[model samples]
Target: MARAPGFWFRQPGPWSAALAPLGAIYAAGTARRLSRGGRARVGVPVICVGNLNAGGTGKTPTVIALVQRLSDRGIRAHVVSRGHGGTEKGPLRVDPLRHAAARVGDEPRLMAAFGPVWVADDRVTGARAASDTGAQAVILDDGFQDPALAHDLSIVVVDAAKGWGNGRCLPAGPLREPVATGLARADMVLSIGGGHAQRQFAARWPALPVPHLTARLQPLKTGMDWTGLRALAFAGIGHPEKFFATLAREGVEIVRAEALADHQPFSPRLLTRLEGEARMLGAQLVTTEKDAARLPDDFRGKVLTLPARLRFDDPAELDRRLDALFD
Candidate 1:
């Protein structure tokens, strides 16, 4: 949605306690919606890379990784996205040269680089269009709760350290659905983080019903090294801190960190302000690749981008799981 409320991640306090009743209603609504039968099925497998939380939890990279892996197997995989931040209500195929993030959403724009992407408010229509256009498989981007298309496989992606955030729903917490209920429907849970974060995640959920897959985000090796580079890092993703942490891991000297709302629009006024700050700080403006997708053409080159992709800890397991759908 928007920038998640701070109280959602923090220990449950008066705010969460006060909002508990509302959270219950929201949770029940989600359960009732998901429990409904007749979720539309398509000809090809619909693999959803979604999350428990309302906002981002590394779903984009996960989809990118899946698309790349599936391509290696000669599968013509296409992405179907709801186009969160865009105005287009369509099963329109995304052409990076034509469609801006303002039209098709940033995540879909990024995914288009890997494979054919369709931006449709109605996911079923999008998946169908992709299948008709020769897609061997359709990858649903963040439609775990939408239930627009019947998924052959649903992978719930989570931040290893932020395990459901106080274990409540909506205003009371960060979850889109309750942990227990969400996990029961998931075919697999992909935990994204470094070793320490994964360790903490494992300690939290000692035993999961579904297969537990672990992965980490690594720099994409684009030949643009940020090591020892003093830069002002700015991002407008769901969890900007994660991007900042990635930069730190890459050995970038962060002179300043600006965290904006998820899918935040970049206006000329805002760009001017950041430009002034960078000028004064004597540091180059830096941002995540996803955020850079939204930047104006004139300003994009001015901002350095650190692109990353997800690397699964055990690819054999993923391959086995994916192979089953084909079988």
Candidate 2:
């Protein structure tokens, strides 16, 4: 997978044009499979919290928020993911402490805290494990495109800032599936952030049949010092720009900022070099909580970590929708 920035934007020219016919054929086959309706074994409700666009549409945070809401209402929610970027083979349980980013993937590890989490290549297998574990509901993170495990509710997440990059798919754009395909299958559209993001969604999908809810991402109250301190911030998330923007909003002075691939694994040498760079620039080294989890335990304490959370401004309406999931 390509890194955050150019992965979505750096579309190929003539080469991709030559392959466009083939891409369309493949997309058609996959979309047809997704449209089928026979595999759904709805022992418990399966809610898919996904995004139409690839990379960072804040799908992880949305899943986390939904998991928390489900637990609050005395419902047992289990989470299942394909465990993208991890090396595991079959169905496996995600233990945040034991499994590194290489084992359970970045997002699954983060979601494991809110409920029972399972990772498997075959989502149906993962769902079976969750059901066996006594989970009343299964929240599939980033699995809307997968057709095997039928979802009862599919909520598509849209980043207000990026706005579905060039409105194209794969080599041409950021989407894993067509925008209309996701919208058609979705039960709701969650437009995240303010300003351009909200305006873009309103303009493009005003007549969508489902409810369009607005969400805001707020940094958790991390009592870290952000006052007038020069620092070097780095992230391997889908959208490093958001990370930098959050730091700026919190009054964190960024002297140097670096962006890497989503869920990049940094070695000891790389960590040492970053520390050296920070020291040379008279700044502290910092990164997002997702990146922090990948850092080796020996070097984790040396760097400052920032945690961010997604909060819905109007939560009452969300509560009602979540209630309907269990009903």
Candidate 3:
């Protein structure tokens, strides 16, 4: 991933202050776009899982969790994404069996295992297509800031470890827009992982009106003996360290942790090198599900994947919110 500025997480420094003018411009442009909203509304309800930060805040997993919940409630839910790294600018349905990450992007390929996934640069087109097929509800993986499609519910996710770094927008900090402005549009604020960031945010804005929800990513029981297994863990997600930390939490002895740019394509040479390094260190290769989806077919069996699911602190509260969408 492109390295974030050091001052992003820290208190405002000279560099952040110097970049404040640009940040203001960026924030203003976002506000102006939001103000002139003409979002297309499909017949089915749309739930948006988005984040204030540019990078991953566990939005994909959150979407998966929500989809599962909707499925359990007998709702036919489908997912829509921007196909961030793919070449196709299409309103195409993702087929895990036929499509590679190169075609539909890694996250959509992974998400397709759960249900239908559609990739289109224009979310409205994708949502319309999904709804026209059989979708009772649509889940937007990102695009909280995009004013292209109307959303029934907007859930903004924030990583508890990296809450509103420096509280500045864009170039000055990590926020895509000002926190308050984004929060004003969000129906719920989901704090993923521990409550530290949520606590910090509350301290920063005690009067914030949005409902706060807490959740953590729990590793799905793979039924494999992972205890004491030495692993060379690597991830190419928005927050790779989070993946490494998850492996460590699951009792895997991490020999080395590698972080590549988000949605990075793993070439044959890189995979061979990673396998060789793992062998040299007497460790097995392991990666996140999204990264595993990007691996070539021949190399996939060689690497183990650690899959995780979102566990909400209050499922009833979430159910109530979801229920409101359909009601």
Question: Clashes in each model (backbone N, CA, C under 3 Å)?
Answer: 0, 1, 1
Better of 2 and 3 by lDDT: 3
Residue 258, candidate 3: Cα error in Å is 0.9
**Residue-level lDDT tens digits of model 1 in 178-201:** 999999889999999989999988
TM-score of predicted model 3?
Answer: 0.96
How many clashing pairs in candidate 1?
Answer: 0
lDDT of 2 by residue, 238-278 (tens): 88878988888888899999988887788778888899999
CA lDDT, candidate 2, residue 118? 90
> Which regions of candidate 3 are displaced past 4 Å?
195-206
Q: After best superposition, candidate 2 residue 325: deviation in angstroms? A: 2.5
Overall local distance difference test of candidate 3: 0.89
Candidate 1 off by > 4 Å: none
Q: After superposing candidate 2, which stretches have Cα over 4 Å from the reference?
A: 4-23, 35-37
How does each model score on TM-score?
0.97, 0.91, 0.96
Best by lDDT: 1
